[model samples]
Target: MRDSFEHVYQLLTCYFVKVRLVDPDFVFDIQTTSCKDKRFTWYFWCFGHPTKTYKLLRPVVMNDETFLKGRYRGSLLTAIAIDPSNHIFPLAFLMKDSKTTESWT
Candidate 1:
């Protein structure tokens, strides 16, 4: 670990990636400590949510060329649906811009 923001970002990306981009209720802060002197001083912030985020994942039939942020950034041409279990499941999302099919896969 070289002590950078990307290190913390990567560690977070690898660990707490269960719910995608949405944050939980109690995850209130992010900090990094540097050894500037004999004492360890940490830099941090309050990133917690004041209100809870409730999402009702429903079964959706979609067809759109949307924008999605990947690891390298690219166009997200996708069709997704939420199962009855509230899981954000991915459906068929790969097609041309003009090709209109009933459903993605």
Candidate 2:
């Protein structure tokens, strides 16, 4: 996992670029600290299709998060909405170093 983190920025850059190519409306944000270590702070992404389709779904949005268990612990936060047909509609997702008030904002 440590090795993977070394290349995480590069990998994510490629991924975000590819996503943009396929979906011009795809949106993403990656935040990093400017400390000596340059640690990754948080990441957020929302696909183009979901953004366009969200208007057709119910207005109510539900959010949930799960703690990650591994060498580098973190939380995976997700936002979702229910469609008129009762199907789960994913709105967005976030990965952060930890679950904190600042992270939620």
Candidate 3:
């Protein structure tokens, strides 16, 4: 069992090393915690231009659905326009079981 754990650990270490090699300018961190309960974290960001790059590239139409993972189950759909820098613009959120392009946008 110990050998198997070590083997997987080595594989994960190599994966992170590859990410670093490809994105030397940006920073990436992956954290796992189990103090009270297991939690996983990951974040990635790039060194970018001084000016806000999130200019609206074009008019956007989006439709997505989300649901509760656990208790108080409900579903919602969100439609949004995103900008050039990956920022949400012209955004709207709605809760529905079903929706359409005309109804959302």
On TM-score, the leading prediction is: 2
Model 3, position 32: C-alpha lDDT score: 40
Q: Could you give candidate 3's per-residue lDDT for residues 10-99 as a string of tens digits?
A: 455466566568756433344444567433222223322212333434555777778633322334555566677767653444432224
Order the candidate numbers by lDDT, best to worst.
2, 3, 1
Tens digit per residue, CA lDDT, model 1, 7-98: 54446424434433464532322222344532211211222332222233363555567543433232335555565776665444332222
Which ranges in model 3 have alpha carbons more than 4 Å from their true place? 1-57, 96-105
Model 2 Cα lDDT, one tens digit per residue, 5-91: 558654775788888898888889988878687777888898776757878999899999999776667888899999899999888
Residue pairs with backbone atoms closer than 3 Å in model 1 (clashes): none
RMSD of each: 15.4, 2.9, 12.0
Ranking by TM-score: 2, 3, 1
lDDT of each: 0.38, 0.81, 0.44
